[model samples]
Target chain A: MVQAAAVAPVPVPVSTEVYQRLQHFYARQMQSSDDLDVPAWAGSFTEDGVFATNAFPEPITGRAAIAAHCDRAFAAQAAAGIVRRHVMTMLTAEHAAGDGERIHTRSYVMVLETRRGQKPTIYCSTLCEDVLVPVDGGWQVVRREVRRDDL
Target chain B: MVQAAAVAPVPVPVSTEVYQRLQHFYARQMQSSDDLDVPAWAGSFTEDGVFATNAFPEPITGRAAIAAHCDRAFAAQAAAGIVRRHVMTMLTAEHAAGDGERIHTRSYVMVLETRRGQKPTIYCSTLCEDVLVPVDGGWQVVRREVRRDDL
Candidate 1:
Protein backbone atom coordinates (compact mmCIF):
# COMPACT_ATOMS: atom_id res chain seq x y z
CA MET A 1 0.00 0.00 0.00
CA VAL A 2 1.30 3.41 -0.85
CA GLN A 3 1.51 5.97 1.93
CA ALA A 4 -0.76 9.01 1.54
CA ALA A 5 0.71 12.47 1.68
CA ALA A 6 -0.99 14.91 4.00
CA VAL A 7 -3.00 17.68 2.38
CA ALA A 8 -2.00 21.13 3.35
CA PRO A 9 -4.52 23.53 4.83
CA VAL A 10 -5.97 26.32 2.72
CA PRO A 11 -4.06 29.59 2.83
CA VAL A 12 -5.46 32.65 4.61
CA PRO A 13 -7.35 35.08 2.32
CA VAL A 14 -6.06 38.32 0.73
CA SER A 15 -6.74 41.68 2.34
CA THR A 16 -9.36 44.22 1.23
CA GLU A 17 -6.84 46.92 0.41
CA VAL A 18 -5.22 44.74 -2.20
CA TYR A 19 -8.58 44.05 -3.81
CA GLN A 20 -9.46 47.76 -3.97
CA ARG A 21 -6.16 48.59 -5.63
CA LEU A 22 -6.85 46.15 -8.41
CA GLN A 23 -10.30 47.59 -9.00
CA HIS A 24 -8.99 51.12 -9.34
CA PHE A 25 -6.30 50.10 -11.78
CA TYR A 26 -8.81 48.54 -14.15
CA ALA A 27 -11.25 51.40 -13.85
CA ARG A 28 -8.63 53.79 -15.13
CA GLN A 29 -7.53 51.48 -17.91
CA MET A 30 -11.00 51.00 -19.30
CA GLN A 31 -12.10 54.56 -18.79
CA SER A 32 -9.21 55.82 -20.88
CA SER A 33 -10.67 56.44 -24.33
CA ASP A 34 -8.42 58.40 -26.63
CA ASP A 35 -5.15 59.99 -25.54
CA LEU A 36 -4.60 57.31 -22.94
CA ASP A 37 -1.66 57.71 -20.61
CA VAL A 38 0.69 55.07 -21.99
CA PRO A 39 3.28 55.06 -19.23
CA ALA A 40 0.62 55.03 -16.53
CA TRP A 41 -1.20 52.20 -18.27
CA ALA A 42 1.92 50.12 -18.53
CA GLY A 43 2.99 50.98 -15.02
CA SER A 44 -0.01 49.10 -13.64
CA PHE A 45 1.93 45.83 -13.90
CA THR A 46 5.22 44.41 -12.71
CA GLU A 47 8.36 45.06 -14.71
CA ASP A 48 8.01 41.59 -16.23
CA GLY A 49 4.29 41.70 -16.62
CA VAL A 50 2.25 40.08 -19.38
CA PHE A 51 -0.67 41.44 -21.40
CA ALA A 52 -2.95 39.56 -23.77
CA THR A 53 -5.49 41.13 -26.09
CA ASN A 54 -8.15 39.67 -28.34
CA ALA A 55 -6.30 40.72 -31.47
CA PHE A 56 -3.20 38.70 -30.66
CA PRO A 57 -2.78 34.97 -31.03
CA GLU A 58 -0.93 34.73 -27.72
CA PRO A 59 -0.03 36.90 -24.73
CA ILE A 60 2.49 39.74 -24.85
CA THR A 61 4.99 39.46 -21.99
CA GLY A 62 7.16 42.10 -20.26
CA ARG A 63 6.48 45.77 -19.69
CA ALA A 64 8.02 46.78 -23.00
CA ALA A 65 5.96 44.28 -24.94
CA ILE A 66 2.82 45.27 -23.06
CA ALA A 67 3.43 48.95 -23.82
CA ALA A 68 4.07 48.14 -27.47
CA HIS A 69 0.81 46.23 -27.64
CA CYS A 70 -1.12 49.24 -26.37
CA ASP A 71 0.69 51.49 -28.82
CA ARG A 72 -0.33 49.36 -31.76
CA ALA A 73 -3.89 49.11 -30.51
CA PHE A 74 -4.27 52.86 -30.20
CA ALA A 75 -2.65 53.45 -33.55
CA ALA A 76 -4.91 51.00 -35.33
CA GLN A 77 -8.02 52.57 -33.87
CA ALA A 78 -6.83 55.99 -34.98
CA ALA A 79 -6.15 54.82 -38.53
CA ALA A 80 -9.55 53.24 -38.84
CA GLY A 81 -11.24 56.54 -37.94
CA ILE A 82 -12.76 54.58 -35.10
CA VAL A 83 -13.27 55.84 -31.59
CA ARG A 84 -13.50 52.96 -29.17
CA ARG A 85 -15.01 52.90 -25.73
CA HIS A 86 -14.28 49.92 -23.47
CA VAL A 87 -16.83 49.35 -20.76
CA MET A 88 -16.13 46.67 -18.18
CA THR A 89 -19.04 45.51 -16.07
CA MET A 90 -20.38 42.58 -14.02
CA LEU A 91 -17.02 41.50 -12.69
CA THR A 92 -15.96 38.51 -10.60
CA ALA A 93 -12.36 38.11 -9.47
CA GLU A 94 -10.68 35.29 -7.59
CA HIS A 95 -7.30 34.03 -6.46
CA ALA A 96 -5.71 31.13 -8.27
CA ALA A 97 -4.08 29.66 -5.16
CA GLY A 98 -3.80 30.20 -1.44
CA ASP A 99 -0.51 32.08 -1.52
CA GLY A 100 -0.30 33.10 -5.14
CA GLU A 101 -0.06 36.68 -6.37
CA ARG A 102 -2.08 35.97 -9.49
CA ILE A 103 -5.80 36.63 -9.58
CA HIS A 104 -8.29 35.28 -12.13
CA THR A 105 -10.81 37.94 -13.01
CA ARG A 106 -13.81 37.82 -15.34
CA SER A 107 -16.10 40.51 -16.73
CA TYR A 108 -18.20 41.45 -19.75
CA VAL A 109 -16.79 44.00 -22.15
CA MET A 110 -18.72 46.02 -24.69
CA VAL A 111 -16.66 47.72 -27.31
CA LEU A 112 -18.43 50.59 -29.04
CA GLU A 113 -16.50 51.75 -32.05
CA THR A 114 -17.71 54.70 -34.07
CA ARG A 115 -16.25 55.33 -37.47
CA ARG A 116 -16.77 58.27 -39.81
CA GLY A 117 -20.10 58.28 -41.70
CA GLN A 118 -21.36 55.20 -39.92
CA LYS A 119 -25.01 55.66 -38.96
CA PRO A 120 -25.14 53.02 -36.24
CA THR A 121 -22.25 52.33 -33.91
CA ILE A 122 -20.31 49.18 -34.67
CA TYR A 123 -20.26 47.18 -31.45
CA CYS A 124 -18.26 44.16 -30.43
CA SER A 125 -18.87 42.38 -27.17
CA THR A 126 -16.97 39.63 -25.35
CA LEU A 127 -15.99 38.20 -21.99
CA CYS A 128 -12.54 39.19 -20.80
CA GLU A 129 -10.38 36.95 -18.65
CA ASP A 130 -7.44 38.58 -16.91
CA VAL A 131 -4.65 37.83 -14.53
CA LEU A 132 -4.03 40.64 -12.04
CA VAL A 133 -0.90 41.06 -9.97
CA PRO A 134 0.21 43.44 -7.24
CA VAL A 135 2.99 45.65 -8.47
CA ASP A 136 4.80 48.83 -7.42
CA GLY A 137 1.93 50.91 -8.87
CA GLY A 138 -0.65 49.06 -6.85
CA TRP A 139 -2.26 46.41 -9.11
CA GLN A 140 -2.14 45.84 -12.87
CA VAL A 141 -3.34 43.33 -15.38
CA VAL A 142 -0.65 40.83 -16.21
CA ARG A 143 -2.62 38.68 -18.66
CA ARG A 144 -5.89 39.11 -20.49
CA GLU A 145 -7.92 36.59 -22.50
CA VAL A 146 -10.97 37.66 -24.49
CA ARG A 147 -13.71 35.37 -25.80
CA ARG A 148 -16.51 36.48 -28.09
CA ASP A 149 -19.89 36.22 -26.40
CA ASP A 150 -22.04 35.49 -29.43
CA LEU A 151 -20.10 32.60 -30.84
CA MET B 1 -10.75 83.67 -12.08
CA VAL B 2 -12.60 80.53 -10.94
CA GLN B 3 -9.83 78.01 -11.21
CA ALA B 4 -10.65 74.35 -10.88
CA ALA B 5 -10.03 73.64 -7.20
CA ALA B 6 -6.30 73.03 -7.54
CA VAL B 7 -6.45 69.37 -8.35
CA ALA B 8 -5.98 67.69 -5.00
CA PRO B 9 -2.91 65.57 -4.72
CA VAL B 10 -3.66 61.94 -5.47
CA PRO B 11 -4.07 59.90 -2.33
CA VAL B 12 -1.53 57.22 -1.53
CA PRO B 13 -2.45 53.94 -3.13
CA VAL B 14 -3.69 50.96 -1.17
CA SER B 15 -1.19 48.30 -0.13
CA THR B 16 -0.68 45.00 -1.90
CA GLU B 17 -1.93 42.99 1.09
CA VAL B 18 -5.34 44.62 0.78
CA TYR B 19 -5.59 43.68 -2.88
CA GLN B 20 -4.61 40.10 -2.13
CA ARG B 21 -7.17 39.79 0.64
CA LEU B 22 -9.90 40.96 -1.70
CA GLN B 23 -8.93 38.45 -4.36
CA HIS B 24 -9.03 35.65 -1.82
CA PHE B 25 -12.37 36.78 -0.46
CA TYR B 26 -13.98 36.79 -3.90
CA ALA B 27 -12.51 33.38 -4.63
CA ARG B 28 -14.20 32.01 -1.51
CA GLN B 29 -17.57 33.67 -2.23
CA MET B 30 -17.59 32.11 -5.69
CA GLN B 31 -16.59 28.61 -4.58
CA SER B 32 -20.19 27.72 -3.80
CA SER B 33 -22.65 26.21 -6.25
CA ASP B 34 -25.44 26.81 -3.77
CA ASP B 35 -26.45 29.77 -1.60
CA LEU B 36 -24.36 32.94 -1.48
CA ASP B 37 -22.94 33.83 1.91
CA VAL B 38 -24.47 37.31 2.23
CA PRO B 39 -23.29 38.05 5.78
CA ALA B 40 -19.78 37.12 4.84
CA TRP B 41 -20.18 38.89 1.53
CA ALA B 42 -21.77 42.02 3.01
CA GLY B 43 -19.02 42.25 5.58
CA SER B 44 -16.69 43.09 2.67
CA PHE B 45 -18.26 46.51 2.14
CA THR B 46 -18.29 49.89 3.88
CA GLU B 47 -21.22 50.89 6.06
CA ASP B 48 -23.11 52.15 3.01
CA GLY B 49 -22.57 49.42 0.48
CA VAL B 50 -24.36 49.29 -2.84
CA PHE B 51 -25.65 46.07 -4.36
CA ALA B 52 -26.94 45.72 -7.89
CA THR B 53 -27.74 42.83 -10.21
CA ASN B 54 -28.55 42.54 -13.89
CA ALA B 55 -32.15 41.65 -13.26
CA PHE B 56 -32.96 44.36 -10.78
CA PRO B 57 -34.31 47.78 -11.71
CA GLU B 58 -32.50 49.78 -9.02
CA PRO B 59 -29.55 49.27 -6.74
CA ILE B 60 -30.04 47.78 -3.29
CA THR B 61 -28.39 49.64 -0.44
CA GLY B 62 -26.95 48.56 2.92
CA ARG B 63 -26.04 45.17 4.39
CA ALA B 64 -29.58 43.99 5.08
CA ALA B 65 -30.66 44.57 1.49
CA ILE B 66 -27.52 42.99 0.20
CA ALA B 67 -28.14 39.91 2.28
CA ALA B 68 -31.74 39.79 1.13
CA HIS B 69 -30.73 40.10 -2.49
CA CYS B 70 -28.20 37.30 -2.26
CA ASP B 71 -30.59 35.08 -0.36
CA ARG B 72 -33.25 35.54 -2.98
CA ALA B 73 -30.78 34.77 -5.73
CA PHE B 74 -29.55 31.55 -4.10
CA ALA B 75 -33.07 30.41 -3.37
CA ALA B 76 -34.22 31.04 -6.90
CA GLN B 77 -31.32 29.14 -8.43
CA ALA B 78 -31.70 26.21 -6.07
CA ALA B 79 -35.37 25.93 -6.91
CA ALA B 80 -34.67 25.90 -10.63
CA GLY B 81 -32.25 23.00 -10.38
CA ILE B 82 -29.77 25.40 -11.87
CA VAL B 83 -26.19 25.17 -10.81
CA ARG B 84 -24.18 28.36 -11.10
CA ARG B 85 -20.53 28.10 -11.99
CA HIS B 86 -19.40 31.70 -12.24
CA VAL B 87 -15.94 31.85 -13.72
CA MET B 88 -14.14 35.21 -13.46
CA THR B 89 -11.43 35.90 -15.92
CA MET B 90 -9.59 39.05 -17.12
CA LEU B 91 -9.90 41.02 -13.92
CA THR B 92 -8.70 44.53 -13.04
CA ALA B 93 -9.23 46.00 -9.56
CA GLU B 94 -8.25 49.38 -8.20
CA HIS B 95 -8.73 51.47 -5.08
CA ALA B 96 -10.67 54.74 -4.87
CA ALA B 97 -11.06 57.57 -2.36
CA GLY B 98 -13.70 58.03 0.33
CA ASP B 99 -13.90 55.97 3.55
CA GLY B 100 -10.58 54.32 2.59
CA GLU B 101 -12.39 51.12 1.64
CA ARG B 102 -14.06 51.50 -1.75
CA ILE B 103 -12.74 49.79 -4.88
CA HIS B 104 -14.01 49.09 -8.38
CA THR B 105 -13.48 45.57 -9.68
CA ARG B 106 -14.31 44.49 -13.20
CA SER B 107 -14.07 41.12 -14.94
CA TYR B 108 -15.69 38.76 -17.43
CA VAL B 109 -18.02 36.06 -16.18
CA MET B 110 -18.92 32.90 -18.05
CA VAL B 111 -21.92 31.69 -16.16
CA LEU B 112 -23.11 28.12 -16.68
CA GLU B 113 -26.19 26.38 -15.35
CA THR B 114 -26.61 22.62 -15.63
CA ARG B 115 -29.68 20.52 -14.91
CA ARG B 116 -29.96 16.84 -14.02
CA GLY B 117 -31.75 15.86 -17.19
CA GLN B 118 -30.27 15.85 -20.68
CA LYS B 119 -31.30 19.42 -21.41
CA PRO B 120 -28.89 21.75 -23.13
CA THR B 121 -26.82 23.75 -20.68
CA ILE B 122 -27.79 27.37 -20.20
CA TYR B 123 -25.01 29.89 -20.46
CA CYS B 124 -25.37 33.57 -19.58
CA SER B 125 -22.26 35.59 -19.95
CA THR B 126 -21.78 39.11 -18.60
CA LEU B 127 -19.45 41.58 -16.96
CA CYS B 128 -19.37 42.05 -13.19
CA GLU B 129 -18.88 45.48 -11.66
CA ASP B 130 -18.28 44.95 -8.00
CA VAL B 131 -17.84 47.36 -5.11
CA LEU B 132 -15.64 45.85 -2.43
CA VAL B 133 -14.44 46.98 0.99
CA PRO B 134 -12.28 45.85 3.90
CA VAL B 135 -14.02 44.36 6.89
CA ASP B 136 -13.29 42.00 9.77
CA GLY B 137 -13.37 39.06 7.35
CA GLY B 138 -10.80 40.67 5.07
CA TRP B 139 -12.77 41.80 1.97
CA GLN B 140 -16.43 41.60 1.07
CA VAL B 141 -18.41 42.30 -2.09
CA VAL B 142 -20.77 45.13 -1.23
CA ARG B 143 -22.17 45.61 -4.70
CA ARG B 144 -22.31 43.44 -7.79
CA GLU B 145 -23.59 45.06 -10.98
CA VAL B 146 -24.03 42.45 -13.68
CA ARG B 147 -24.29 43.63 -17.27
CA ARG B 148 -24.98 41.47 -20.28
CA ASP B 149 -22.58 41.37 -23.16
CA ASP B 150 -24.56 42.47 -26.17
CA LEU B 151 -24.43 39.74 -28.76
Candidate 2:
Protein backbone atom coordinates (compact mmCIF):
# COMPACT_ATOMS: atom_id res chain seq x y z
CA MET A 1 0.00 0.00 0.00
CA VAL A 2 1.16 3.52 -0.74
CA GLN A 3 1.84 5.60 2.35
CA ALA A 4 0.53 9.14 2.72
CA ALA A 5 2.98 11.89 3.59
CA ALA A 6 2.80 13.11 7.20
CA VAL A 7 4.00 16.66 6.64
CA ALA A 8 1.53 19.50 6.46
CA PRO A 9 0.46 20.59 3.01
CA VAL A 10 2.04 23.76 1.73
CA PRO A 11 0.11 26.31 -0.28
CA VAL A 12 0.55 25.98 -4.00
CA PRO A 13 2.39 28.81 -5.70
CA VAL A 14 0.59 30.84 -8.37
CA SER A 15 0.98 29.45 -11.87
CA THR A 16 2.72 31.29 -14.70
CA GLU A 17 -0.33 30.91 -16.92
CA VAL A 18 -2.41 33.08 -14.59
CA TYR A 19 0.31 35.69 -14.53
CA GLN A 20 0.34 35.89 -18.32
CA ARG A 21 -3.42 36.40 -18.43
CA LEU A 22 -3.10 39.27 -15.98
CA GLN A 23 -0.46 40.93 -18.14
CA HIS A 24 -2.82 40.60 -21.07
CA PHE A 25 -5.54 42.19 -18.99
CA TYR A 26 -3.42 45.28 -18.30
CA ALA A 27 -2.29 45.51 -21.90
CA ARG A 28 -5.93 45.55 -22.93
CA GLN A 29 -6.99 48.12 -20.36
CA MET A 30 -4.17 50.60 -19.80
CA GLN A 31 -2.40 50.43 -23.16
CA SER A 32 -5.42 50.99 -25.34
CA SER A 33 -5.66 54.34 -27.21
CA ASP A 34 -9.24 54.04 -28.38
CA ASP A 35 -12.06 55.14 -26.15
CA LEU A 36 -13.02 52.41 -23.69
CA ASP A 37 -16.42 50.82 -23.85
CA VAL A 38 -18.03 52.10 -20.66
CA PRO A 39 -20.61 49.40 -20.27
CA ALA A 40 -18.20 46.73 -21.36
CA TRP A 41 -15.59 47.85 -18.90
CA ALA A 42 -18.04 48.14 -16.06
CA GLY A 43 -19.57 44.83 -16.98
CA SER A 44 -16.20 43.22 -16.52
CA PHE A 45 -16.96 42.91 -12.81
CA THR A 46 -19.28 41.23 -10.43
CA GLU A 47 -22.87 42.34 -10.28
CA ASP A 48 -22.29 44.30 -7.09
CA GLY A 49 -18.87 45.56 -8.05
CA VAL A 50 -17.49 48.79 -6.62
CA PHE A 51 -15.46 51.45 -8.39
CA ALA A 52 -13.60 53.93 -6.22
CA THR A 53 -11.46 56.82 -7.36
CA ASN A 54 -9.34 59.36 -5.56
CA ALA A 55 -11.55 61.89 -7.25
CA PHE A 56 -14.72 60.33 -5.84
CA PRO A 57 -15.87 60.83 -2.28
CA GLU A 58 -17.37 57.36 -2.17
CA PRO A 59 -17.14 54.27 -4.34
CA ILE A 60 -19.64 53.79 -7.14
CA THR A 61 -21.23 50.37 -6.68
CA GLY A 62 -22.97 48.11 -9.19
CA ARG A 63 -22.70 47.97 -12.93
CA ALA A 64 -25.21 50.69 -13.69
CA ALA A 65 -23.49 53.38 -11.64
CA ILE A 66 -20.06 52.32 -12.78
CA ALA A 67 -21.12 52.41 -16.42
CA ALA A 68 -22.77 55.78 -15.96
CA HIS A 69 -19.61 57.20 -14.42
CA CYS A 70 -17.46 55.90 -17.26
CA ASP A 71 -19.89 57.24 -19.82
CA ARG A 72 -19.83 60.62 -18.17
CA ALA A 73 -16.06 60.75 -18.13
CA PHE A 74 -15.82 59.67 -21.76
CA ALA A 75 -18.45 62.22 -22.72
CA ALA A 76 -16.58 65.00 -20.95
CA GLN A 77 -13.46 64.07 -22.85
CA ALA A 78 -15.39 64.03 -26.08
CA ALA A 79 -16.71 67.50 -25.44
CA ALA A 80 -13.17 68.72 -24.92
CA GLY A 81 -12.28 67.18 -28.28
CA ILE A 82 -9.15 65.76 -26.77
CA VAL A 83 -7.62 62.36 -27.39
CA ARG A 84 -6.07 60.78 -24.33
CA ARG A 85 -3.72 57.87 -24.09
CA HIS A 86 -2.78 55.95 -20.96
CA VAL A 87 0.51 54.11 -20.71
CA MET A 88 1.21 51.77 -17.87
CA THR A 89 4.26 49.83 -16.70
CA MET A 90 5.50 48.11 -13.59
CA LEU A 91 2.42 45.91 -13.52
CA THR A 92 1.81 43.02 -11.15
CA ALA A 93 -0.91 40.54 -10.17
CA GLU A 94 -1.56 38.32 -7.14
CA HIS A 95 -4.18 35.69 -6.59
CA ALA A 96 -6.54 35.45 -3.60
CA ALA A 97 -6.83 32.22 -1.64
CA GLY A 98 -9.61 29.83 -0.59
CA ASP A 99 -12.17 30.35 -3.36
CA GLY A 100 -9.53 30.85 -6.02
CA GLU A 101 -11.84 33.30 -7.76
CA ARG A 102 -10.46 36.56 -6.44
CA ILE A 103 -7.30 38.41 -7.44
CA HIS A 104 -5.56 41.58 -6.31
CA THR A 105 -3.85 43.43 -9.14
CA ARG A 106 -1.98 46.73 -9.30
CA SER A 107 -0.04 48.73 -11.88
CA TYR A 108 1.66 52.08 -12.48
CA VAL A 109 -0.16 54.12 -15.12
CA MET A 110 0.80 57.42 -16.80
CA VAL A 111 -1.86 59.27 -18.73
CA LEU A 112 -1.01 61.41 -21.73
CA GLU A 113 -3.63 63.99 -22.58
CA THR A 114 -3.54 65.82 -25.93
CA ARG A 115 -6.10 68.22 -27.30
CA ARG A 116 -6.73 69.09 -30.94
CA GLY A 117 -4.55 72.19 -30.96
CA GLN A 118 -2.46 71.83 -27.78
CA LYS A 119 0.65 69.96 -26.82
CA PRO A 120 0.17 66.70 -24.99
CA THR A 121 0.46 67.13 -21.26
CA ILE A 122 0.75 64.26 -18.85
CA TYR A 123 -1.55 64.23 -15.90
CA CYS A 124 -0.82 62.73 -12.50
CA SER A 125 0.79 59.34 -12.25
CA THR A 126 -1.94 56.94 -11.25
CA LEU A 127 -2.14 53.52 -9.68
CA CYS A 128 -4.81 51.07 -10.66
CA GLU A 129 -6.05 48.75 -7.89
CA ASP A 130 -8.44 46.03 -8.81
CA VAL A 131 -10.15 43.18 -7.03
CA LEU A 132 -11.06 40.57 -9.62
CA VAL A 133 -13.57 37.81 -9.09
CA PRO A 134 -14.23 34.94 -11.42
CA VAL A 135 -17.76 34.50 -12.70
CA ASP A 136 -19.42 32.34 -15.32
CA GLY A 137 -18.01 34.41 -18.14
CA GLY A 138 -14.42 34.89 -16.95
CA TRP A 139 -12.39 36.83 -14.42
CA GLN A 140 -13.92 40.25 -13.89
CA VAL A 141 -13.05 43.13 -11.62
CA VAL A 142 -15.28 43.34 -8.58
CA ARG A 143 -13.71 46.39 -7.06
CA ARG A 144 -11.42 48.98 -8.61
CA GLU A 145 -9.64 51.75 -6.75
CA VAL A 146 -7.61 54.41 -8.52
CA ARG A 147 -5.32 56.54 -6.42
CA ARG A 148 -3.20 59.34 -7.77
CA ASP A 149 0.49 59.04 -7.09
CA ASP A 150 1.69 61.73 -4.74
CA LEU A 151 4.14 63.93 -6.59
CA MET B 1 -17.22 0.16 -23.85
CA VAL B 2 -17.37 3.76 -22.66
CA GLN B 3 -18.04 6.29 -25.35
CA ALA B 4 -15.10 8.56 -26.14
CA ALA B 5 -15.94 12.25 -26.46
CA ALA B 6 -13.75 15.20 -27.25
CA VAL B 7 -13.85 17.76 -24.46
CA ALA B 8 -12.13 21.12 -24.81
CA PRO B 9 -10.22 21.90 -21.68
CA VAL B 10 -11.24 25.21 -20.17
CA PRO B 11 -8.57 27.29 -18.52
CA VAL B 12 -9.13 27.39 -14.82
CA PRO B 13 -9.41 30.86 -13.30
CA VAL B 14 -6.55 32.44 -11.38
CA SER B 15 -6.25 31.23 -7.84
CA THR B 16 -7.57 33.46 -5.07
CA GLU B 17 -5.29 31.71 -2.59
CA VAL B 18 -2.29 33.42 -4.07
CA TYR B 19 -4.07 36.72 -3.85
CA GLN B 20 -4.73 36.31 -0.14
CA ARG B 21 -1.07 35.57 0.48
CA LEU B 22 -0.21 38.69 -1.48
CA GLN B 23 -2.51 40.68 0.81
CA HIS B 24 -0.49 39.40 3.73
CA PHE B 25 2.70 40.29 1.93
CA TYR B 26 1.53 43.89 1.45
CA ALA B 27 0.33 44.14 5.04
CA ARG B 28 3.72 43.01 6.25
CA GLN B 29 6.13 45.01 4.08
CA MET B 30 4.24 48.19 3.22
CA GLN B 31 1.93 48.76 6.18
CA SER B 32 3.85 47.37 9.13
CA SER B 33 5.04 50.10 11.50
CA ASP B 34 7.02 47.93 13.87
CA ASP B 35 10.74 47.51 13.48
CA LEU B 36 11.29 44.97 10.73
CA ASP B 37 14.10 42.47 10.63
CA VAL B 38 16.20 43.87 7.83
CA PRO B 39 17.92 40.56 7.13
CA ALA B 40 14.70 38.63 6.90
CA TRP B 41 13.05 41.37 4.87
CA ALA B 42 15.96 41.29 2.46
CA GLY B 43 15.80 37.53 2.41
CA SER B 44 12.27 37.84 1.04
CA PHE B 45 13.83 38.35 -2.38
CA THR B 46 16.14 36.24 -4.51
CA GLU B 47 19.90 36.56 -4.19
CA ASP B 48 20.09 39.17 -6.91
CA GLY B 49 17.04 41.23 -5.98
CA VAL B 50 16.80 44.79 -7.21
CA PHE B 51 15.95 47.89 -5.18
CA ALA B 52 15.77 51.35 -6.67
CA THR B 53 14.66 54.78 -5.55
CA ASN B 54 14.15 58.02 -7.42
CA ALA B 55 16.54 59.66 -4.96
CA PHE B 56 19.30 57.50 -6.34
CA PRO B 57 20.66 57.27 -9.86
CA GLU B 58 21.17 53.49 -10.12
CA PRO B 59 19.34 50.45 -8.87
CA ILE B 60 20.80 48.49 -5.99
CA THR B 61 21.08 44.79 -6.77
CA GLY B 62 21.41 41.62 -4.67
CA ARG B 63 20.29 40.82 -1.14
CA ALA B 64 23.45 42.18 0.43
CA ALA B 65 23.04 45.67 -0.99
CA ILE B 66 19.32 45.61 -0.34
CA ALA B 67 19.92 44.71 3.27
CA ALA B 68 22.75 47.18 3.55
CA HIS B 69 20.56 49.96 2.28
CA CYS B 70 17.85 49.11 4.78
CA ASP B 71 20.41 48.89 7.58
CA ARG B 72 21.80 52.26 6.61
CA ALA B 73 18.37 53.83 6.60
CA PHE B 74 17.56 52.39 9.99
CA ALA B 75 20.92 53.40 11.38
CA ALA B 76 20.64 56.90 9.98
CA GLN B 77 17.29 57.39 11.62
CA ALA B 78 18.66 56.10 14.89
CA ALA B 79 21.82 58.16 14.75
CA ALA B 80 20.01 61.32 13.84
CA GLY B 81 17.55 60.71 16.68
CA ILE B 82 14.84 61.57 14.20
CA VAL B 83 12.33 59.14 15.78
CA ARG B 84 10.94 58.58 12.32
CA ARG B 85 8.19 56.27 11.19
CA HIS B 86 7.21 55.14 7.72
CA VAL B 87 3.47 54.89 7.07
CA MET B 88 2.39 53.19 3.87
CA THR B 89 -1.10 53.09 2.48
CA MET B 90 -3.02 52.76 -0.75
CA LEU B 91 -1.09 49.55 -1.31
CA THR B 92 -1.80 47.23 -4.21
CA ALA B 93 -0.07 44.03 -5.39
CA GLU B 94 0.21 42.25 -8.72
CA HIS B 95 1.89 39.11 -10.00
CA ALA B 96 4.84 39.53 -12.35
CA ALA B 97 5.37 37.14 -15.25
CA GLY B 98 8.62 38.43 -16.66
CA ASP B 99 10.45 35.57 -14.94
CA GLY B 100 9.22 32.09 -14.27
CA GLU B 101 9.30 32.31 -10.51
CA ARG B 102 5.95 33.03 -8.88
CA ILE B 103 7.60 35.16 -6.20
CA HIS B 104 7.44 38.23 -8.44
CA THR B 105 5.03 40.96 -7.27
CA ARG B 106 4.57 44.71 -7.94
CA SER B 107 2.72 47.24 -5.87
CA TYR B 108 1.96 50.91 -5.27
CA VAL B 109 2.68 52.40 -1.88
CA MET B 110 2.00 55.82 -0.36
CA VAL B 111 4.60 56.59 2.23
CA LEU B 112 3.82 59.03 5.03
CA GLU B 113 6.71 60.20 7.12
CA THR B 114 6.38 61.34 10.72
CA ARG B 115 9.35 62.90 12.43
CA ARG B 116 9.77 63.80 16.09
CA GLY B 117 9.32 67.54 15.69
CA GLN B 118 7.85 68.19 12.27
CA LYS B 119 4.25 67.50 11.35
CA PRO B 120 3.64 64.24 9.59
CA THR B 121 4.68 64.68 5.98
CA ILE B 122 4.57 62.77 2.74
CA TYR B 123 7.82 61.11 1.85
CA CYS B 124 7.04 59.77 -1.60
CA SER B 125 4.14 58.02 -3.22
CA THR B 126 5.66 55.55 -5.64
CA LEU B 127 5.07 52.15 -7.18
CA CYS B 128 6.93 49.15 -5.77
CA GLU B 129 7.85 46.59 -8.41
CA ASP B 130 9.03 43.41 -6.69
CA VAL B 131 9.92 40.00 -8.04
CA LEU B 132 9.50 37.17 -5.54
CA VAL B 133 10.79 33.65 -5.97
CA PRO B 134 10.31 30.52 -3.92
CA VAL B 135 13.42 29.15 -2.28
CA ASP B 136 14.32 26.20 -0.07
CA GLY B 137 13.05 28.21 2.88
CA GLY B 138 10.16 30.22 1.51
CA TRP B 139 9.31 32.96 -0.99
CA GLN B 140 12.05 35.49 -1.73
CA VAL B 141 12.12 38.51 -3.97
CA VAL B 142 13.94 38.35 -7.31
CA ARG B 143 13.93 41.87 -8.72
CA ARG B 144 12.31 45.09 -7.63
CA GLU B 145 11.66 48.36 -9.44
CA VAL B 146 10.24 51.56 -8.06
CA ARG B 147 8.63 54.06 -10.39
CA ARG B 148 8.15 57.46 -8.81
CA ASP B 149 4.71 58.93 -9.06
CA ASP B 150 6.13 62.27 -10.11
CA LEU B 151 8.37 63.40 -12.92
Alpha carbon lDDT of each predicted model: 0.64, 0.61
Q: Show what share of the native A-B interface contacts model 2 retains.
A: 0.00
- lDDT by residue for model 1 over A1-151, one digit each (tens)? 1333245434334456545655656656775533455687777666777766556677778888877877887888778676555667677767765547777778888765545444224267888888777666456666777787665
Show model 1 residue runs off by greater than 4 Å. A1-151, B1-6, B9-13, B32-48, B117-122
Candidate 2, residues A12-130, lDDT tens digits: the string is 43455666566566667653333666756666767898988786788899888877877888888888887878765444566664545567766555566888889776554566778
Docking class of 2: incorrect
Docking class of 1: incorrect
Q: TM-score of model 2's chain A, to 2 decimals?
A: 0.80
Model 2 ranges off by over 4 Å: A1-13, A31-34, A117-119, B1-41, B44-62, B70-151
Error of 2 at A81 (Å): 2.7
